[model samples]
Target: MCNKHLMVVLIILAFDLAVATDSGLETTQAGGGLENRPQRDVSCRNHQEYPHDNICCLSCPAGSYVKSACTSAHERGTCENCDFDTYTEHDNGLLQCLKCTKCRPDQEIVARCTNTQNTECQCKAGRFCAPDQACEICKKCTICKDDEVKVRNCTTISNTECKRQLSTSSNKSGAVAAVLVLIAGSTVIVAFLKRKKKFVGEQDSQNPSEMEKVVVDSGSGLSDEEMQNKLNGRLYDSPLLEQAQAVGQQALANKEKETKQGNSFTSTAHSSPASLPTLPSAPLPAPYPHPRPVSPSHPNTRDDDLPRKKLVPLNGDKSLTDCFSYFEEVDVHFHNRFFRRIGLNDNAIKNRENLQPEDRVHQLLNVWLEKVGMEASINDLIAALLHLNQRLSAENIIAKAISEGHFEYEGKQPRDESQL
Candidate 1:
């Protein structure tokens, strides 16, 4: 019975060992399957990438788009060039390039789109928008009110700035003080006139001949002939003389009116006219100091006269300065040439190079004005434009000057007298 129990134990041990060996073979087969399958949750270097079949594929460089995914790890995908009007700004794993931005009607293109970079745009002339703010649309530039003055012109990234005008109040105060001074002066003059009349009457009663020998109250000691001449001069310069002149002018106007009436009545009664109204002679054209030279390009321009119209300032020097803003319309390509033609030196123009085109034009113009002093005129600027064959800009500036009341065509007055 002991020998039978030992045989049974040996058989059971062999069976247990065989079962453990089959289980080990199955585990080995499962481990081999895992090695052949694609990786999951794999780590990749920090760059641009895309996942394909549980594997990370490196992205294409800028200006390109991924055409295909990599077949294996540690490899890049196929890439193709971006089409026109499309761009990829940086290394991207995108299947297609991004579409380029289009500038709005109110905006202008600053930089065109390329495969490597997107388009850049900004507000056009006379408009602005802040970059930090949500720029749904560009805004119209602010025009300063009459009671305000422009501090800075509008730029693409900033709007126009204005400040309250200070000169208006100062002018009002000065006018009020001037009126008060005039009133006080009139009072003193009236008192002196009364006292002089009384003294003259007392002197005349004493002796008519001795009146000439008496010293005059005038600050200067003078001979009899000199005092008589001074008295005659005062009478000629007095308000009474002005009143007499006004009366004479009024009588002349009435006589002219009567003459017109007579002429009208005579013309009504007779076939022949009594008198024809005298026509005023035409005014001769004013001569320009430096006439614009006739050019082959401008066949219509006359050698005797400049093709451009002459601009007469409405408010003298102030009008010339006021029209300085119009010069900002000058073409950027012709800036240096235009200014140089206007007599600005190279150093003067170079110094203002850092300023914006508009501000640079203004500074260079101001420098030219200072150098020319009272001789500065808009005509000089216009002539310079003509010299440079920039007639269109010259004409536009003249139109703006006339339209804005800063200037007018010679011999032609603006219909609105208040503007003058």
Candidate 2:
């Protein structure tokens, strides 16, 4: 009964201590009630690593720190700096309302300071900080992490875009691009072929109107035999005949060229003939194969007295030159090829006297007449002939479109009234 009474008395004392708070709110009672203002203060003189101004307890600044209790109600000295992450702009009296730290420029915001003691922080949507972190500052988000793909771009606000290491559009675009390429290529090829054919035709065609005026007079039609005979007779005095003569004379020169070729080939074959097995006597390489010689015309049918000369100088050989029908020849050889095809048919054919593209070739005749060395005009028959001939000789040219006939000059034909 006496022990029970002691317990009740103890309960009453505990109740009284818990209430009637005048002991400056309250204090941890160690030995007695209302003990001399709790003399043992937490010493913070040595704890100075962070919050330089804040130690055990003191007032933190306004716009900066938080109230985490004071070291004493009486002057316990000024507050030290807040926790490393916490801030106090200036004097905050006894209350230390801390300032929230901003994330660094390269980082994003995590948790904002709040009313509760358990403040939560998180990296902005795409960012993250490692564990054991207060997250006073957050870091930038990771770019594409998948190794197979790479980050193509990272916009200021948008998420980082990942691109395939290889080209993704290749498969689909390849076919379409191929088709477009084929069309373009085919167009180019067709144009090229047409140009080539036109060129060949220019080179080979005989513009009949150039050399001979089509005197569609009140004339009569001649027989085929007469025409054939006339043609055959004309062949005796043709440019072909002149060329043949030149060739015959140049045979020795041609032979020399062949000899030169053989010599060069032999020399080229042996970088150093030391590589060859040395015999007691050396042997020469074989010469290039020569074309088989053609037989001369049958004696009975041959021209018994055709003039022949090694050097037929073209100075004033009226006989050799007059043999060329200059007036008729240029007309027959150039007009149809160059002028007519280029949309100047009627006028170009009619004005078949001069071959002049523009300036240079036009003045060649003058140059030749004056014995001047240079050709002034590029429009002349020879120049046009050269240009067209080069085009015709290309790898992909047509011959038929360029050529009209091998000038087997049949003498004459009467024009029908219907032709007019």
Candidate 3:
């Protein structure tokens, strides 16, 4: 029995040993199968550095063209020189050399084509490309207009530039216009002055005795009122003055009769023919007040006693309105002279030609206030205007209006005295 147990244990040990040896052999065979598996070759170089047909080949050198492919590894292709107008900038494996670019009609070759570079183009002297980037064709340069001038001449890379011809032409035209206006104005003024002088000479010749009498009376000791009355009586034979004198005499007689009646009422009444009444001598009527000259030291005082003349609307159909209307009625040249005397600037004077009558009046008033340093009364302003007219010509409506006191008031009742 002991022998039998020992033999059984030995047989079991041999079976376990056999199983371990078989597992080790199977693992070795599996590892050897994995080691024998095939892998694809991944060492093929890029075509740009090493081109290939059946094997890899070297690239062509710079400044050369590839004419044929290599048949073996580590070898270059058949290389050749580029044609005259052709180029090859890099080691390209191309079958043919590149053709050079041709310049357009408006372009010129800046750099000629060579083995290593292409041609470069630029615009000609008088032409330029419309779009500068990679431009295929060039366009003609811009031409300046008649009223324009060239600022920059055209170049290979840039277009022509221009600027307007305004400064010289505008300034010259304005100066010429101003000069012509001044010359024409001066000519008109000279002619007007000569005509006025001739008229004055004729008037003096016709009224020599009257002028001499005035000179004689001025030296006399007569008061201004008496002198004026005497002058008026000698100068005019109008019925208005005579009628005014008769009315004054009638008023004086009525006052005297009232005074005599009052004395009789106060004293005892007597009914005798010789003691009844005595007629008071009628007093002479006072002369109408003459316009006072404007005193330089007291300009405001000139219009204090004068009646205020009512202003008429500029659009009114009445013969007279403001002083500006009188200026317009005279002549355009006379009006311009008046504006100059009032110290209006050139712009304002020029603008006056286009203004309406009312606008002109306001403008004149403003200018007068600025120059005279004071507000102008209607009478004083009109008197100054009339005075200006007298300086220009002898046949002045304003002067006659002032002398005859025709411009007293705008409404019905005319005043007796002439102001300013």
Candidate 4:
């Protein structure tokens, strides 16, 4: 029985060895099959290649598309040109090119679509669009108000920008304040001067003997008899006498001017002075060196019942030009007639009609200055306004001219000149 058991055990061992060898052969066959089979899709260099059939194929170039994918690894694909109105903007592995963008009705084409680029568009003039936001539609540009000024015009990327105009009312108020201050200062100065004069007058009114003794005491190199002669004649300068003399001189000048005007009118009516060829009369002396002061009680202080303020320019042509803005106060209805009087032609005036009223006034005044050359004067413009019956405008302009220091009222000769 033991011998039988040993043979059985040997048989069993041989059977187990055969089962082990068979299992080993099956495992080796399965490993070999796995090694020979295709792998799963692997990672690709995205810029250079794309995956197809579990392999990486080289990508097509710009302006073209992949008509057929590469069958092998690391190989180029079959590429075809992009169709019209379509684009492939970069090296791509796409089935077909993308459709080009269509600009809206409000937009203008900046660049047309090409194989490698898409269309570019922008809003037309008088319109705008923001680039950062989706441009579903363009927007209308803004218009500035009458009191506002244009800072920048509208463009495709930016809307119109405006700035509020500086108020002319403020300027007028400031000018008025300056005038008040000046008037107040003048009043103070005049009061001080009057007080000083009063003191002198009181001293002058002393007893005659006292006055004579004081004059003798003075260190003047003259005899008492000569000094007495001076006191008797009141040779000391008198303000009242000087003022009366000035009034008389001004009246004489006006009478002379009127007489000349009358003679010129009468002569012209009878016959042309140029044609008559008469001998030239003596040149009239220059009118009184200063203008007459305005006083309702004084008959010679006015011209034709119109209050006159003599305006002497501070800077010649510059003063005239500086006063141009004052003309804006002129009545709108009288603009054409007023400028025409200043020698502006219909065309010259019409050319500036589109400008704002103030701007038109300024521009046309410059044109007038150019035409009149150095002979251009604010006085002439003022006279023209007066002729047009724009008396209020003329007055306002004159006041502005004087208050702004472009001109000064030549009311009196300097004190030193009067003394001489």
- Candidate 3 shows a clash count of 0
lDDT of each: 0.71, 0.39, 0.56, 0.70
Candidate 4 is scored at a TM of 0.36
Please, what are the lDDT tens digits per residue for candidate 3 over residues 250-340?
A: 6668677757788664353344445534432434445445533444344343233334455332333232333344454544445665666
For 1-420, candidate 2 gives per-residue lDDT tens digits of 999999999999998776655433434567665443422333443322122232354334433343354444323344445554455444444345444555555554445644222234445554555556565555454354333354543332444456546656876697787787677667656765675555446436532111111111121233343344334444433443344444444654655665777866557647756543222121222221331112235222222122211112233333222322222333334435544322343543433233333322233333333442342221232233333332222111112111322121113233122211
RMSD (Å) per prediction: 20.5, 31.4, 28.9, 21.8
How well does model 1 score by local distance difference test? Answer: 0.71
RMSD after Cα superposition, model 3: 28.9
Candidate No. with top TM-score: 1
Choose the strongest candidate by lDDT: 1
TM-score of 2: 0.21
lDDT of 4 by residue, 104-169 (tens): 999999999999999999998879998888889999988776667779878898887989988699
Candidate 4's clash total is: 0
All candidates' TM-scores?
A: 0.39, 0.21, 0.30, 0.36
Compared with the true structure, the alpha-carbon lDDT of candidate 3 equals: 0.56
**Residue 182 accuracy (lDDT) in model 1:** 75
Model 3: clashing residue pairs? Answer: none
